[model samples]
Target: MAITSANQLELLQTAEAVAREKMIDPALVIEAMEESLARAAKSRYGAEMDIRVSIDRKTGRATFTRVRTVVEDDELENYQAEMTVDQAKQYLDDPKVGDTFVEEVPPVEMGRIAAQSAKQVILQKVREAERDKQYEEFKDRVGQILNVQVKREEYGNVIVDLNPGEGVLRRNEKIGRESYRPNDRIRVYIKDVRREQRGPQVFLSRTAPEFMAELFKMEVPEIYEGIIEIKAVARDPGSRAKIAVISYDGSIDPVGACVGMRGSRVQAVVNELQGEKIDIIPWNEDMPTFLVNALQPAEVSKVVFDEDAERIEVVVPEDQLSLAIGRRGQNVRLASQLTGLDIDILTEEEESKRRQAEFEERTKLFMDTLDLDEFFAQLLVSEGFTNLEEVAYVELDELLVIDGVDEDTANELQARARDYLEAQNAKAMERARELGVQDSLVEFEGLTPQMIEALAEDGVKSLEDFATCADWELAGGWTTVDGERTKDDGVLEPFDVSLEEAQNMIMTARVMLGWVDPAELEADAEEDAELEEEQEA
Candidate 1:
C-alpha cells in the first residue's frame, strides 16, 4: 500500500471508522497510523535512519521526514541519523550538539509483510485506547446499582454488556441458584472495577448487602433525599436479610417509610432479590435496645452486655428461646452482624441457674478467705462483696450497712480479709521466685504478685519480655478467625488487667530500659489529647 494522493484521504476515513467502532478517540487511531507508517519507512530507508511520519488532520495528507541530530565529534555513532558538530556545516550555521536536522523524504510503499505489521500495530493501539476509555468511564461507578443485559454465560459466570464495556457476575455473586440466558436484563451492584492485564474488569454482584440497600434507596424517596439513612445491612441472599435504618426527620418513621404504604416499597426490593424476606429495624444508639429490635418475633427477658469483649447475652423465656435463635441460629446471627457484637442466647431458667451458681461460688470464697461462717459469707455476698480486695479496701460505712454488723465487726472483717490477701500475695511471690522471675518484673508498679507469678508461668520472666508483649497479650482479647470469634487467654487477665493499663505499663518499661524516649511519649500523649478535643468539638 502506497501513501499516494489517491489513497491519502482514505487514512482519515479509516481512522474515524475504527474510532467509532471501538468507541475511542480518532486522534489515537491517527497516531497509531503515523507510528505504523514510520516503522515501514524505517524498514525501506534503512533502520539506522531517523525516519518519521505525520498525517495532517485537515487535509489527510501524509508528510514524510527524516530527522538527524547534531552531536559532539566523539559522540557521533550513526552516520545516517547523527552528525558531529564540525561535520554539520552543510545543514545550517551554528548548529548545537543537541539540535536536530529535518528534511522531507519520499513515502515508502508498504509490502505484504510491512502492511501486515502495520495492521497489527494499529489494532494493538486501538485495543489499548478502548481499554483505557472503558476503565475511565466505569472506575467511579463502583458501589452503584446498574441495569445490565446478559451477553453470555462462561462456565457458571454471567457476562453482562455495560454498553461501553463488559461486566462479569460470578456464580457465587448471584442470588441462590438464579440462572439467566442471553439478553436477560438484571439489576446488579457494581462491586468493583479493576484494571487488569487483558483489560478493565467490572465485577457485578446481586447478593451484596449494598445491593439491597441500593434497592431501598431507589424505592424510598426519604432514603434518596437523605431524610432516612441505611445504617447497616446483613443478608442471607435469596433467603432473609436485616436492615437497620435511622430517620433524621422526627416526623418520619424509618421502618414505616421503608415498609411503604401497603408494603409496596419493600415488596419491590423483595421481588428483585428473588423473594428474600427483609427485617427493617429502627436504628438506636443503645446497642442492647437495637439488638432487641433486630431479634424480632421473640421476647427478650434480659440483656447483659460486655462492652470490652463486644459480646451480648440475651435471656428469654423457655418458649421464646427457639424463636430468638431461629432455625439454625439465623436470627441471632443476623442480630450479631447488625449490632457488631457476638450474641449468646439463653433461657430465663438457664440464666437463673448460672446466677445462683455464681452467688454460691462467691459465698464459698468469702467463707474460706475471711474466716466467716456460711450465713455471714452469704450476707457479705448479698452485699456485693465478690472478692477479698473489695471487702478489705471498702469504706467502713459500707460494711456497717450489712445486717448485725457494727463498727467492731467491720474492722475485724477488713482485718481478716487484708491478712488473707497479704498471705496469698506472699505465696504468689514465693512461687514466682521459684520460677526464676527477675526483680525488674516483680518491682514493676502496676503488676501484682499474682500477675508476676502468671507472667513467670507464661515465660515472660524479665522486664524486656514484658515490654515486648502486645497489649492484647496482657489483657485477654477476642480474635475473629474464619468468621468465628475465639478467645485469647492473657497471662495477667486473671488479675483484671485492662488493655489501656497494659499499654501504659509496657511503655513505662520501654522508657525505663532506654528503648523509648520519654519526651516522645509525652508529645504523643499531647497529640492524642488534642485529637480527642477536636473530635469532641
Candidate 2:
C-alpha cells in the first residue's frame, strides 16, 4: 500500500466510514491515520529520526516530514534528530540553539508486516476515541434512569446495551434475584460511569435508592415540575421502601401527589421495582418529626435526639415495639437511613424504667457526696440538681424554692456541696500530679481538675499535647464504619465537654503555646464571613 493520488481520497473515505461506525468524530479517525503513518515512516527511515505526518482534511493528502532541532553542543544527544547550532548554519542564515529544521520526506511504502502494525495502531486509537466518546456522553447521566435492553449475562451480572454503549448491572445492584435473558428491556439507574483500561464502564443499578426517586420524578408531574421535591429515600430493594417528599406549594401535598389519584402514580413505580412497597411520608424540617413519619404504622410515645452523636431514641408503646422495629429490624434500619441518624427503639415501660434508674443514681450521688439523708437527697434530685457542681453553684433562690427548704437550709446545703466538690477537685489534682500532669495543662483555665486528671490518664499531660489533639478526640464522636455508627470515647468527654468547647479550648492552647497565630485566625474568620455574605447575596 502507498500514498498515491488514487488512494489519497480513499483514506478520508475510510476514516469517515470508520468514524461513522464508531460514532466518533471523523477528525479523530484522520488523526489516528496520521499517527500510524508517522510510526511506519520512522520504521522505514532511521528509528532515531523525528518523523511526522499530517493529513489534509479537505484533500485527503498525506504529508511526511523529517524534523531536527538545533541545540547546544552539550545538549545535542540525539545525532539524527538534534544538531548543534553551528551544524545548522548550513540550512539557515542564522540559527539559534532552539531553532528547528524541517524538510519534506517521501511517505513510507507499507509492507505486509508494516501494514499490519499500522492497522493495529489505528484500531487501538479508534477504540480509545470511542471509549472517550462513550465516557463523555454518559458521565453526566449518572443518577438518571435509562431504558436499555439486556444483552447477556456473565455469571450473575447482567450486561445491558445502552444504544451506543454497554452497561453492566452487577449482581449486588440487582433487585432481589432478577434474572434477564437476551433482549429484555428494563429501566435502570445510571449509578456510575467510569473510564477503565478495558473501556468506559457504565454501571447500572436497580436497587439504588435514587432509582426510586427518579421513578417518582418520572411518574409524578409535580415532582418533575419542582412543585414537590423528594427529600430522602431508603429502600430494601424488591421489598419495602420509604420516601420523604416536601411540597414547595402549600396547596400541593407532596405525599398525595406522589401517591397520585387512586394510587396510580406510586403503583407505576412499584410495578417497575418488582413489587417493592413504598411508604410516602411528608417531609418535615424537624428531624424528630421526620423520624416519626419514617417509622410509620407504629405509635411513638416520645423521641429523644442526641444531636452530637447523630443518634435518636424513640419510645413506643409496648405493643408497638415489634411494629416499629419491623421484621428483622428492617423498618428501623430503613428509617435510620432515611433520617441519617442512628435509631434506638424502646418501649415506654423500658424508657420509664431507665429514667427511674437515672433518678435513683442521682439521688444516691446527692446522698453520698452532700452528706444528706435519703429524703433530703431525693428532694434535691427532684429539684433538678443532678451533681454536686450544680448544687454548689446554683442560685440560693433555686434551692430555697424547694418545699420545706428555708433560705438558711439552702445556704447550708450549698456550703456542704461546695466543700465536697472542693475536696474531690483537690483529690483529682493530686492524682493528676502523681501521673506527671504539668502545670500548663492544670492552669489552662477551661479544664477543671477532674478534666486534667482524665487528660493525664489518656497521655495528654501538657498544653502542647492538648494543642495537638483534635476536637473530636477531646469531645468524643461517632464514626460510621461499614454503614454502622460506632462511638469513639474521648478523654474529656466524661467532663461533659462539647465539640465546640473542645475546639475553642484547643485553639486557645495552641495560641498560648505560640503554635497558632491569633491574628491569622481572625483574618481567616473575617474572610469566611465575607464569603458567606457573598453567597447569601
Candidate 3:
C-alpha cells in the first residue's frame, strides 16, 4: 500500500492517536499496515500474482507491488524451483520463488482505509494485554484496600477509575451514608476479583468482618506482634463489637494493651469505625466466667449451663437486666457469639420466684404424708381391733379401695398404722420375756432393741440361736437385714467397718469355736436344756 496524498496523511495521524490510547508503540502501526496490504494483494491476484508491501512510519507512505510468477521448462503456473528463461524475461531477470516483482497497488484515494485496518489490530491486541495485566495485579489484592476515583453511574452501579483501569461498585457494596462525586477519592476493600471480556474487574466491600480486623491490626501493635491473639470477634458494625482476646505470655495484659494508655489505641480503632464502641474481653477457659466477661458493662450474678441444649441462662441483678440485654438485645446477642453459647437472660427477681414455686411443691408433699396417717388409723379399726400379728400381715394395696382412700393416702396410712401395731407387739414380746424367754433367744449381736423384741416373738432368743438359723429364715437374704424389713419397722442394718476390723473379728470367733460342727452343737444345746429342766424340778 502506498500513502500517495493528503487523505493518507490523516489516517496515519489517527493511528498514532489510537496507539497512544491503547498504550501500544506507534511504530507497530506501520508493520500492521504492510501485513494487511500483502494479504489483500494475494487475494486480488492468483498464481500469476506476486506482491511486496512496505511502509514508512514517519511519512505515512505505504506501497504495494504486483507481478507474475516465473516458471522454468515446466508448464506449471506457479513453480518452487528456478524460473524458465522465457518466464523470467517476461516478468523480470533474477526472479525466484521467494522473491517478488514490484508494481504499485495502493489505491490512490483509499490509503486511509488501509491505515485504519492496521490501527484496529493494534488497539485490540493492546486491550487484551492490558486486561491480562490488570487481572494479575488485582488478583493478589483481594483483601486489601485500593484507592479509587468516582467516575459516573451506569445502570445503578458506580464506575470508579483506578488510574490504569476502571472498576464497578455495585449498589449493595457502596455504603449508604458515604457518597461520591466525580474525581472524589475513596478507599475500598477489594472484595473479589473477576476476569471479563473488557478487563479484570474488582469488587469492593465496606461491611466485611475482615475490614474491622484489618483496621484493628493497623491501629494496635500488640495484635501485629502476636502478643495478643483475637480468639473471637463479633460485630454489629457501626455500633458495637465484642472481641475475645488472650495473651500468649502471662506477663502481658491483653485488654489493657488493646485499650492503650488513656484509651488511645482503641480510640483510634473506634474513629475508623465511625465512633463504634468496642469491648475487649480477656478470654478464659472457664465457660461461666468467660460468658460473664463477654457481656461487660453489665454485671452478671450467675450463669447456669444447660449442657444438653448448649445454652446458658444468665442471671443479672434486677437493675442490670437491661444492661446485660442491651438495646433490643444487642449486647447479649453479640456476647453469645463471642462465647459460643446461646444465652437466655433473667433477672434475680424472676429466678427467686421460680425457686419459691419449687419449695412449695416439696412442702405439699410432706403435708400429704401426714394426712395419710389419720386415714390409715381409721382403716385399721374398721378391719378389726386387730392383734399386732394381723396388722403386719395385711396386704397394702387391698386397703387402697377402702372407703375414701386413694393410693398415696392408703399407703401412708398403712405405714403409720403398722408402727402402732409393732409397738404393741414389742410389749407382748416383753411379756414373753418375763415368762422366762431364754437368754439364747435374745443375744444376737448388732440387733436393735426393736429387732430383738420382734425376733423373741418368733422364738429366736439369742445370738447363739440366731447364728444357728439360716439367713433366709431371718430376713430371706444374705444381707445383714431381711427382705421383710420396711422403713417404719425393720432391724437396723450393720454400720460400715474397715476390712481389717471385720477380718479380725471373724478370726477371733473361728479360733474359739475350733471348727465345731453346727449340727452337733445344736443337739448338745437341746440336751443341756433338758438337764436344766430336770434340775429345776
Candidate order (lDDT): 1, 2, 3
User: Model 2, clash count?
Assistant: 0
**Lowest lDDT block of 10, candidate 3:** 483-492
For all predicted structures, in order, the TM-scores are 0.90, 0.97, 0.47
Candidate number achieving the greatest lDDT relative to the actual structure: 1
* lDDT tens digits by residue: candidate 3, 1-537: 445576557658866875677665555655555665665555555434556676666666666666544444665555532355655666676666445444566543225664576556655656665677678878998888766788987766778887677887877665445556788876667889899765688877755656666667777788888888888888776778888889998898998988999999889877766677889899998889899899899999988986533579999999999999999989998898687677889899998897666555444433343343444444544555233334345676666647776778666655755666567557756875864566544443444455556556666564444545443344322222431222222221222222333334333334344545657767877999999999999
Stretches of candidate 3 exceeding 4 Å from the true structure: 2-118, 147-159, 168-176, 285-287, 305-310, 349-537
The per-residue C-alpha lDDT of model 3 at residue 136 equals 81
Residue range 1-537, candidate 2, lDDT tens digits: 899999999999999999899889999999889988998999999899999999999899999999999999999899999999899999987999888999999888999888898899999999899889989999999999999999999999999998787999999999999999999999999999999999999999999999999999999999999999999999999999999999999999888999988999999999999999999999999999999999998999999999977889999999999999999999999999999999999898899999999999999998888788899999988888888888889888898889999988989999998898899899999999999999888888988899999899899999999999999999999888998889999888888899999999999999999988999999999999999999999
Misplaced by over 4 Å in model 1 are: 42-53, 61-107, 514-537
Summarize candidate 1's per-residue lDDT along 1-537 as a digit string, tens digits: 899888889999999999888888999999999999999999999999999999999788999999999998888899999998777788879889899989999999999999999999999999899899999999999999999999999999999999887999999999999999999999999999999999999999999989999999999999999999999999989999999999999999999999999999999999999999999999999999999999998999999999977889999999999999988888998889889899999898999999999999999999888888999999999999889999999999999999999999999999998999999999999999999999999998988899999999999999999999999999989888977889998777888888888889999999999999999999999999999999999
* Selected candidate, larger TM-score, 2 vs 3: 2
